[model samples]
Target: MREAAVSPSPLSPSPLSSAAAPPARPVRSPLSGRLAGLWAAAGARCALPVAVLLALGFLAPLVAIFAYSFAPPRSFDVFRAFSLANYAELFSPSNTVWLSFAWSIGLALFTCAILAVVAYPIAYGLAFLFGRWSSLVSVLFVFPLFVSENVRLYGWVLFFIKNGVLDGTLKWLGLEGAPAVLYTPGMILAGMVYTYLPFMLFPLTLGLSMVPRDLIDAARDLGANRFQIWREVEVPLAMPGILIGMLLTFVLAIGAVSEAKILGGQSVIVISHDIEIAFTYAQNWPLGSALAVLVTAFIGALTLLVFARLDLDRLLGRR
Candidate 1:
């Protein structure tokens, strides 16, 4: 049987049809997408102020200091020439710059230790026990900050010096041979601890405050004692505050020349004092700049190390 011839339908496109597949949508890279998003979020107006401020306030000074560090001896003109002579002088046996650094660092560590030990309990009490009174106590703790550092330190000087208030008080009580704390390293450390105690306390209190009471209760319910709760729960939670406080105190202590001069006099030598001497007395701006750079670099490295170990977003409540 002959089959009926089939007709080709016009509706069906042929294999060579000109009709094109929908143009493939272009894919965007993550980096470009992020940049776009950032631009959109930042806008133009908001970014200008921040950028300008950073350039003028932060970058300019930082660049100036870095340049000045390599400037030639006795000159503040960083453009003159670059030299390592200033840094090299720090290592010279007679210079004692390294010793000054060691003393500064040692004092900072001691101050941090004292602050941690003393402030932690006060902060813990404020966070957990003070209740409505915590705010008032906190205000009191920071009251010393209202006064200038110089004034506060001088007050300590009066209290600690021989034949001063403290000695007079003891003598009034009929006690003899009161130890002379003035111009001693111990007095210097005491003054530093007193000066920066508020810095440590405030950060620690903030950190301790972040810890949830519910967690402590839960730990206790799980048969954890006070020490266990502290070690396993509280300490870990408060670590960010502790780190920040200690770092702040350490940085403040090491950078202060006034404290060493006023409290320790000529006996105690810190890096800041040496830097001051280099710039003011020796008229060696380059040497002072080198010391400043060294101190700043050391502080930056330490801060970076702390931040690296911490989940900063979480610590700052940004996450």
Candidate 2:
């Protein structure tokens, strides 16, 4: 139409114009900087005490033991002279050190196996089968933990001793002359199992509890049988807990000397008892220290092995 063009007014703003952008925050306030510094300082201050305590109480002893392991026999001083005599004697073919190690380690392994078998069923029952009553059952399982360890082991002692509670009960039930189990290897193993059962069971229960119900349902919907579901789905999921339980049970069982002493009496000679004898009666601090170092190293190696097998992210459900 070629209408006559008119010039735009200078004072009017355009409707299509965008809003002004806010200014960028290029720097933090001084107060915020000071507060962050204070927080870091406070955390460091809090951690200092614990770090110092660990260094003094834990690291110092380990250092002393390691130093003493290199010392000569009958010497408490680690700095008097450095020698390999103790280690040489320790690994000597004539010594029974290896046998003692085998005995202690074998017992610990056996105990771990038993605990695994027993704990799985208990954990499964608590987490799956028991349902609403699981909490009550858990409390009952943990009730024994409230009692002193020594007292619990002593109770086992009373139960296993000749004519003690077990024998008395059996005789009362018309079973005469029950065999005494006290001070035997079997009794020691049984005591260890009773004492450490909770350790294995609790972890397995926690693991089993975390297994997805949806996964189980899906498995069932897929026509998977109970055993198949458990073996293929449940077990793989609960592996972290099983490994943790195994590690804990094995470590505790292996290091246990008091249980062996009280339950095994003079019947079985574990590496721990041998170390005790070397330390106290034989006055051979070097030998004792060497054995202690060996055990500590062995445990460290086992821990590394366990960590190697564990997927940390998967275990924590991060994956």
Candidate 3:
């Protein structure tokens, strides 16, 4: 067997060399790799400044308020002492602050309902009927916002006060004197509706604008009546804007103080007024902080619930 061994030719390849070799990978410089990573993250890096600004401007105050909320009632020793006394006091049976909460919530609800009904027609006109004049009408609506809210509210006070413009005009016209409608809950609600009407109208208009006219025409072609189209198509499409308008109106109305003060006088007390009293007149910082915390929590929870049901991608037109 040793004598039978044969010599291999130089052209013949070995078994190991018969298979194709894998290509060597190109090595990149560390600096280039680092630059690539930085470029990829450029957007997030750019956002850092805004994030810092928000943390400072918005979150910092919330953190302070939250910390103060747990402090002992009627004390400014924030972050030094922690107690549930403020909350306990608010929850106590004798506390009539609940009445203030009820008033604020009820007034806010009424304002929202009124604004929804009143703004819808106007919003519809703005979206579909006003045509080229829409911008002018919108500007007119926005013009009121530039004036001070307090000034506007005070003007209403003068107009509605006894022997003011209405009463004087009525008497001059040989008609019965104007009814004593000032300094009433009804007046406060009226003021709120007036103040928050624009907020509701604009959002509703935006939502209505999102609805495609072609789809509406198609629905009509399909024998869908006006009510059916509105219920099945328009409402579903414009829901985001409607919800946004309602939420904005509700939030502003719930925290209203000037309306109650300037119009309702002492007829009604809202939660915001109570908080102001706690912070200013009563000098109860903890109590104010607690009230603020509760209000914020309620709003946050409601907002979350709304957002949970919202199709954000659809609203944003990402889809």
Candidate 4:
């Protein structure tokens, strides 16, 4: 109203010359700077022991196995002379190793599949059936490990022998005969299933317990049938346990020499047996090492392919 000359707005900073001015920096004390440095140092120091252990555990053993694989067949004393003769003999048709390995792979696959089917129901019971009995059931499943592998194998031997349970049952059933299950591949699979069933069950129970009941119900309400719920909802969610159990069961079963040697009557010639024969009976460490390495490489490749194909995280769950 007075018509006085208007001055620049007091609150507005002049952008013409002040555009280059920096904003206020965060305040930091010398003590705070020292503390930041100390925190980083502490973290690094804490990590050192773990790093050392990993180097010893993960790297050292792998390096030793690699060295052993390439060692000379004639003498273990030789260093890095580089020979493929052991590998050549390994793949030879006369060895029966290829056939043996194929059989072993078959047994492992069959065992894993059976265990998966058997364990799913048990896990389902533990998750949905047992309730207050869940802890007892889980304990019962784990309790058998205290029996020892040798004892477990021996027990199967007793059960499968000519006059064992099945034969006894046959005698009672008026058939008066059941062919001996002992020393057979079927016996081997039974033992495999008995021993490793708990592995699949425990993990699967853990997986199932994690999946909410409401989620299953919601899917069902939306027209998801029992098969669809399992295939789409339950399986996807429980994939971590299933995949882990499958891998463990398969890998361990494929490497099984004990069940075959002890219960299957040593008639079974598996890859593990091949490795053993090369070392024990043949006294050819180099050949054994090479065969071992080859089998290991094959399994390692298969595991990688399976994990990649399945998208491992789907099994691991969303963290």
Best by TM-score: 3
**Top-lDDT structure, candidate number:** 3
Q: Candidate 2, residues 217-256: lDDT per residue as tens digits?
A: 9999999999999999999999888889989988888888
Clash pairs detected, candidate 4: 240-315
Please give the distance, in angstroms, between residue 44's alpha carbon in candidate 3 and its true position after superposition: 5.3
Ten residues in a row with the worst lDDT in model 1? 14-23
| Per-prediction TM-score | 0.85, 0.86, 0.89, 0.83
> Per model, how many backbone clashes are there?
0, 0, 0, 1
Give the residue spans of candidate 4 off by over 4 A. 1-37, 40-45, 78-80, 164-178, 306-319
lDDT of 4 by residue, 176-199 (tens): 677767888888888889888887
Q: Give candidate 2's whole-model lDDT.
A: 0.88
lDDT of 1 by residue, 211-234 (tens): 999999999999999999999999
Q: What lDDT does each candidate get?
A: 0.88, 0.88, 0.92, 0.83
Write down the TM-score for model 4.
0.83
Query: Candidate 2 has what TM-score?
Result: 0.86
Compute the lDDT for candidate 3: 0.92
Would you list the rank order by TM-score, best first? 3, 2, 1, 4
